[model samples]
Target: MSALTMPLAVRVIRAEHDALAAMLRTLPLLLAAQRLALVPPDFGALRAMLFYVDEFPERLHHKKESELLFPKLRALVPGLRGTLDDLEMDHAQGERAIRELQHSLLAWEQMGESRRDKFEQQLRVYSTRYLRHMKREETEILPHAVRHFSADDWAELDEAFGGHQDPLAPRAGQAVDEAYAPLRQRILAELPAPFGWGPALGA
Candidate 1:
């Protein structure tokens, strides 16, 4: 096949898709340090970071695809039947993970060091497991989607997501530069040397 021309939705989705993975890799380390190490975490900063990583980027960006992209794909490829069901279930599973970890986020953020340690352990395990789920969607599912979705389909999907409020928007003026600055730089640097839409993005 000729070089894949990513519609704007694909382009933005791919960025978010990889960005969430990159954040997942670092979050465990952040929690690990919060526990065994003596440094005190700024709950505000950590919460801000997670807001973007967990909610804004992944839940918002990827979920929009399920709401928007899958319907178009199903129209194009009847063989893709049940794909949306599986994708929706996967998203629910991810939300379940978030629900389970919700208390831990509060504990780590609100309580003192003692509670932080306990919360850290639980959060790390949950994050590591969640990363595996993300990998399945990115590799097994997203590439197959790119293969069949047309430029017009992608354009409509892009418009759909554009209207949705970004979950991280509330923190953009404050937490973005202070809390997530390092992470944003780290992700751009750590992306796989050969990365892009289609096969180049870890297909």
Candidate 2:
């Protein structure tokens, strides 16, 4: 197949989707560690990861897709309104899922053993839901956007998506984004060499 000449927004969204999917895949490992009582779950690392999810994707990525990209795509593509609406609804549901997962994590951390199972269950559910949502957008919505959205539309969308700072999740003053900076360092320090943050393999 020929390579797609995709909009900048499409490329950025796809990269973010892959990264978040990797995090979702790692959650089960964390849960297993907690259950086996082997290498204890790094609650701090997990918390940082979850916070990053909330701040970046749930806050910034999905909002831009729903409010800006999706609307434009629906207008340009015939018979896309239903699919676009479904994706928008998924974004709303995903946000609620994240909030619930956050509460469960806090309870697990503070209340301890009693909340373990509940936290794990919520985490798994949220991961599954989010992964499914992202996959649908990747397979269905992104293709439609790439095919139908005008160059001018892509240009504007690309510029908005390519902002240096997250449009929705900015930090206080000149400080780094709370959810990303420390979390990234924590991931690098806490995770093993392969899993830790840093340059990708053979980079």
Candidate 3:
């Protein structure tokens, strides 16, 4: 069969891979900031990254994988369904991890030392789990799912996220906020770290 006709499950997973790959590189950026203790810490920049964790992959990618992709995989291979269920659990846990990361970032920026220490420890621990989870997916799960997904599904997914408003798209009044006052200036000043600086972090 042609590429587009490949299983929908595979197509969607591949797209998820691409998106995850892009977002994963930001970990180092976060780590850099954590290490440097960059003054006037750009919490906005950090929040923008966290926003993607909640918004893009969680909302779009995981939704498709959990809802659309996994069901069919189970149908084709009965045993596979259990593993897919485990994956769903992983996604669910990821939300809590991101939430914790956000709390730590904000607290650290505000110079709450005890909270910062606690959060940093959690953040590193969570990062390890997240990376390990991704490895499991790429290595153990992707090959089987790929056999079922189609290129058409991948194309459609690509289009949907392509429409996602620019992550850098500030809140409606943000521009005006920057123009009018110092608070706005601080908020606007916290631009996203150079996530685009390196190679295409895609699979």
Candidate 4:
């Protein structure tokens, strides 16, 4: 669908998904480069990126999907219950997963090189799962929503999804909120060109 014709909630969700996917793709590269250089991992930047995932996508984006979008879709489609259930399960597990990642990150930071492999492995698993989860939503779930949802449904979903801007992926012309400016900056600064808005890594 054209940008002007698409539902606001759909637009927001896709943009958020794109932003998140970029960050997920960047994490391993960032870690690998640091390791190759024999430089210390920038724990603060890594934390900020992960925290953004937790704070924005996990807390805000997925909550709206679970509470508003998924339930509504389930009611309308009925046939999609299985898929929706799986997505919801992913949502439920997301918090615990992020917390575990954070804990692994801390362990790696505190225990030195021996712990690095564990955190990297966990990150890989988490990223792959999340990427697949989003792919299902976009391909399986969202298309059904587009077909089934009424204008009223879009109205409600738009209100909920559009209420808050993602700090890392603000809409065009929307400035990053001050509260998240530092976190956003840290992430951009850490990630290289194409992956982030900031300068290239090592530049």
Candidate 5:
């Protein structure tokens, strides 16, 4: 699509959704690796990944939407109140869910393999909630904004989303969140090759 067609903010938001979806797809592998011991779970890598979930998407992305995008949209289209409220609730719940997952990660790391089932279940729940949340934003909210919001609105949204100064050096031409760089590296280094950054077993 042309630049005139898709607002930069929407593009950025969609990028985040895609990134989170990729991460969520890893959940099964992550949990299975932990449960079956097919490969030893790198609790440190797991923690780092979860920290990215909490810090970047949950905190930065959602905060931008809730604080800036949603409020502006609410004023532009009053009918969006219910959907906006639901989305906001999802954001809040996501924070709590991340905390639960963090706690589970710590417990498993420190105490051995006691709450594996609980951790897996919580991971699945959080993933499902997050996927659903993003789906709503994509299907219901973004299209509405594109339709109802003005050019000025789009400009402001793009500026707000794009203006954040990433605190880390750009890697592969894209800015990586500073805190997540190590986590990204760890995922590459520890996980199996092709899909993972690390070497394959018995290689």
Candidate 6:
């Protein structure tokens, strides 16, 4: 659907999801290229990226999904209760998972190459699971919402989702927060062409 015609909340959700998915996809490539080139990982950049994921997707995006969107969906379509439950559970686990990832990243950064494989493995698993989770929501949950949600429901959701613009996916004419500027640059710098405007990693 055209952006102008789409519900504001749906637009916000899709944009945030795309931004997150791009970051998630770029991270493995960044790590692998660094490994292949025998370069030390950019620990600061990695930390920034992980912090963005935790701060935006895990905290902000999922908060809206679980507290507002999913509950509304469940109430409107009781048949969706099962899927919504599973998605909510994923949201709950995501906070803990990001914490574990942050810890693993710290360990790898401090403890040398011996800890690298473990962090990489955890990141791969986390990324894969999150991608799948987003796919389910887009395909299953969002379609239902688009069909079922009333004007009032859309207004409420739009107000909540629209209030917080993701730094990685700012709305038109909106500047990213100053606090996130460096983090945003780091991500764009590492993300390869086609996936992002930045230069390819290890190029």
Q: Sorted by lDDT, highest first, which candidate order results?
A: 4, 6, 5, 2, 1, 3
Worst 10 residues of 2 by lDDT: 164-173
Best by lDDT: 4
Q: Give the TM-score of candidate 6.
A: 0.95
Tens digits of per-residue lDDT, candidate 6, 1-203, equal: 67689998998999998989988888888788879989788788788889999999998999989889998888889998888888889999999999999999999988989999999999999999999999999999999999999999999999999998688899999898888888888877766776766666655
Q: Whole-model lDDT, candidate 4?
A: 0.90
Which pairs, if any, clash in model 3? 6-149, 6-150, 7-148, 7-149, 7-150, 8-149, 8-150, 10-149
Q: How does model 2 fare in lDDT?
A: 0.73
Question: What Cα-based lDDT does every candidate model obtain?
Answer: 0.58, 0.73, 0.57, 0.90, 0.76, 0.89
- What shift in Å separates residue 189 of candidate 2 from its native position after superposition? 3.6
Candidate 5: which pairs clash?
Answer: 188-197
lDDT of 3: 0.57
**Which ten contiguous residues of candidate 5 have the minimum total lDDT?**
164-173
- Superposed Cα deviation of residue 87, candidate 3 (Å): 0.5
TM-score, cand. 5 vs. native: 0.84
Kindly report which residue stretches of model 2 are placed more than 4 angstroms away from their true locations once superposed: 1-5, 164-179, 191-203
Residues 1-203 of candidate 4: C-alpha lDDT, one tens digit per residue? 78678899999999999989988988898788888889798899888988999999999999999999998888899999999989999999999999999999999989888999999999999999999999999999989988999999999999998899898779888888889899888888888888786556666
lDDT of 5 at 45: 74
Which model is ahead, 1 or 6, in terms of lDDT?
6
- Model 3 CA deviation exceeding 4 Å by range: 1-40, 149-195, 198-203
Model 3, position 164, has a per-residue lDDT of 37
TM-score leaderboard ranking? 4, 6, 5, 2, 1, 3
Cα RMSD, model 2 = 5.1
For each candidate, what TM-score against the reference? 0.66, 0.83, 0.63, 0.96, 0.84, 0.95
The lowest-lDDT stretch of 10 consecutive residues in candidate 3 is 165-174
Distance from true position, residue 50, model 3, in Å? 0.7
Point out the higher-scoring one by TM-score: 2 or 6. Answer: 6
Candidate 2 displacement at residue 116 in angstroms: 0.8
Please name the candidate that would achieve the greatest TM-score relative to the true structure: 4
lDDT of 5 by residue, 1-203 (tens): 46456998887787778767766766566557545665567787788778878877888889999998899889988998999999999888888889989998888788876866677778888888889999999998998888888888888888987765322213235666665566677755655544465554334
